[model samples]
Target: MTNQSNNSVKKTVLVTGAAGFIGFHLAKKLLSEGHSVIGLDNINDYYDINLKYARLLELGIEKNEAETYNNLCNSKTHNSFSFIKMNIEDREALPILFKNQDIHIVCNLAAQAGVRYSIENPEAYVDSNVTGFLNILECCRHHNIKHLVYASSSSVYGLNKKIPFSTDDNVDNPISLYAATKKSNELMAHTYSHLFKIPTTGLRFFTVYGPWGRPDMALFLFTDAISKNKPIKVFNNGQMERDFTYVDDIVEGVTRIINKETAERIQSNKFYKIYNIGNNNSVKLLDFIKEIEINMGKEAEKLMLPMQPGDVERTWANVDDLIKDYDYRPNTSIKNGVKNFVQWYNKYYNS
Candidate 1:
């Protein structure tokens, strides 16, 4: 971990998907840095609503109290942070939020985020990731947001045999609808940056896991199954690998970009950039499971299965651009990261 760097001047920042794992952590980080943060999420039931509510609970917003959509709920723990229950695709409401909140920086982290789920529910991906991101770009254009930071995905590098996926590498061959939408987000952001001159940066995140993670993610699902003595379905017959970046490292990279001054990022052509934020260390599935088992003090009963649809064999991120620009490097190893997650899971679930 690096020293906490405060923003030169505190600005009003809006974080979409505030109830989600990454959003919640980023919002918390910004608020702790003394910035006024307005978090927005529809609180969808993609995985577990209770888990979402628990994340909100950590942000000091009572789940029952955040009922009204688009209505702001002040955080009980911090004066600078507030949250709202809303969908980003709401065309009419999104613009109103930008104008009313006086938002300076827009962090678009909300999306229908599951490669496999995108196979079954394609419309959900288009509606949220595509249409919703368009709405965000429109709002940033009209309201003159200083900078727009959005989440991209490592899945965009689908089927690439390259060792380390770079931002400069070709990502046109997306294997899943989820990856396609995220790639579309990068294209959309570039267009907006060129036309409207809205400074935008897209981050392609690798497998992010830690406390308060989504239950649908591999780490959380495997942890839960192992704790309950249930058989965990390991896809690809446990022959997969992922550059599992820790949640705090992702947040650190995001905040560094968000706090960057306008002069620091204005490129010659357009104020648009993309960076991959990953640990740069890929670990195999079996080794990752071993770390989890060691942390939990129980070995998982694994059910080896072939790869499912919309799945990839491996993903590795080349974070050279992120390192060169932001001086950010993911430091948390899988051992410590899994330990932290297991500790949180045990305490949160009283298992």
Candidate 2:
């Protein structure tokens, strides 16, 4: 763990889901610090492959060159970065990856993301989020990885009806399969930390929106529809609220915790911990829409819709622990975040 603060050590970091938004950014940051980085992903056409490729390109990995089937690595790279097109669900391939690389830190961000999608694709969620995560914990435990940081979600605090959800809140009542899987991840990590002494941190992310965001997220959906002069659906009759943490803020918070490992035993103390990485600022759906409108300088054709299943009425993370532990600060205002997102959207899509 000497490499924790020593930049000269240049430890290799494994970023699962490197082609994904958060993973891409975190990998790039590690590379910039002169640490060798291995970016792992199945590169499944879950969303637009182009967006994933664009993120890789930013990391100096080209898509045409990154072509690979299951259990194969494209071997594409920057001087400090390498990408492998491997799914975490492939337990066989996962341990091989951990054994082959001198991976000092492992960031598990590759789970099947999205709440509503999990409802329709329950099998995929269990496979990627549950089975896949077990594979990660197993690999990390055996590989002697220094720290394992994984993505948890605010959705796990389902039906709590609490303002600014806290880590102390009971999260056994997850409404969505996705939420349940994420909660399961935290539990699983805690077990490993207790049994095997594998230091782990699970981050409960709120609604993360920003430049180069996911296509399925509301930020992307609203921007796309408004720009095309199409009506955008407002779920829950525009009554929904979210603590939309900007991607930059989330990445910064993740980076802060990625280097440090909690060493206390779970039984003796809080060896495994979960922190809420959120904006700590909630905005109503209509207000969010208006912000997008202001940023895009285009009014959206409103399509007020009922509350969608598996969707929460509100999410606001109480980030006091984050601030107390790591001095976490989220600076992007909705107006500013939306503007940056809109700029990226127009530039990326040539709108």
Candidate 3:
């Protein structure tokens, strides 16, 4: 049975990695759409715990309450939203939460995210992306989850020289551990969808950015360094390109997939699918930096450097499947997107 609100079916969604960039935006979007949300995150110090706590505060969960483990904290602003401070790898506790929450949908966005960082700390990727994802699949297999949507990365395309990477392209040669883990997730999701008959969809997000974005991303890094009169690292000697999709656009695609009727998405006798969620236009790295400089009203000191290990030179996502299936339209241009991020950075850090 499903709850109906505001001419839409209101679902109880369990969104893991609720403190992360895409997760936070997705959670806010879900709440505004009248869905009941149960947010889960360990709030790891991958970048800054303060930023994570700040995002939670926006969702009406206090910092003091967000710090406690395994304790459910209800939202003060939205009665339909609640949060739990926990890791997905907590195999024992995760299942119990699934049993109690009556979650109709599961969106697993919780995973160790950096490509270079995965090379330095490989275990973190295995723990969170592999083992933790296994737990999510187990819960879905046991519990009658209506649909499971999870995050995959464009890095999974690895060293593919193919332009406009598509789901039909071969992804067997992931260069980094992070990419390998995400590819493994696609395989795992496929397995569960085939064996257990669980409907699952995975999104391959390409260079997501915008307000409340991760500090480690290029937009934030460049903005902060330029504002501080410091040099920004220009990788691949400023010869790279990325399909930098805005956060709101990515969230829109996600919400569409979440709310889509399961009966309409089956493919090849299996209820599994994968789509690329991206701007569909790859902008040059230097051009992206130029846009940031334009927004910040300052020039960036570029420290031209060789491409780092485990990093791809360019990423261009082919989002044709997303467009065909969900009417996913990523229309945010790099200019407006960078302007929005710069405005947010100035307000968030200066004020």
Candidate 2 backbone collisions, by pair: none
lDDT of 3 by residue, 1-351 (tens): 012233558899999999899999999989989898999999898999999999998898889877654553332334687888888998988888888778999999999999989988999999999999999999999999999999999999999998989899999999999999999999999999999889999999899999999988999899999999999999989999999999888998898888877865555465998989899988999999999989888889899999998888889999988888878888888899999999999999999
Model 1: lDDT of residue 325: 82
lDDT-based ranking: 3, 1, 2
TM accuracy, model 2: 0.94
Which regions of candidate 3 are displaced past 4 Å? 1-7, 72-78, 266-268
Q: Which candidate do you rate higher for lDDT, 1 or 2?
A: 1
lDDT of 1 by residue, 196-294 (tens): 888999999999999999999999999999889999999999999999999999999899888888775565555999999999888999999999999
On lDDT, the leading prediction is: 3
Query: Any runs in candidate 2 off by more than 4 Å, and if so which?
Result: 1-9, 68-74, 261-269
Candidate 3: what lDDT? 0.89
How accurate locally is residue 115 in candidate 3, as Cα lDDT from 0 to 100? Answer: 90
lDDT of 1: 0.89
What is every candidate's alpha-carbon RMSD to the true fold?
A: 1.7, 3.0, 3.1
lDDT of each candidate versus the true structure? 0.89, 0.85, 0.89
Candidate 1 weakest lDDT stretch, 10 residues: 68-77
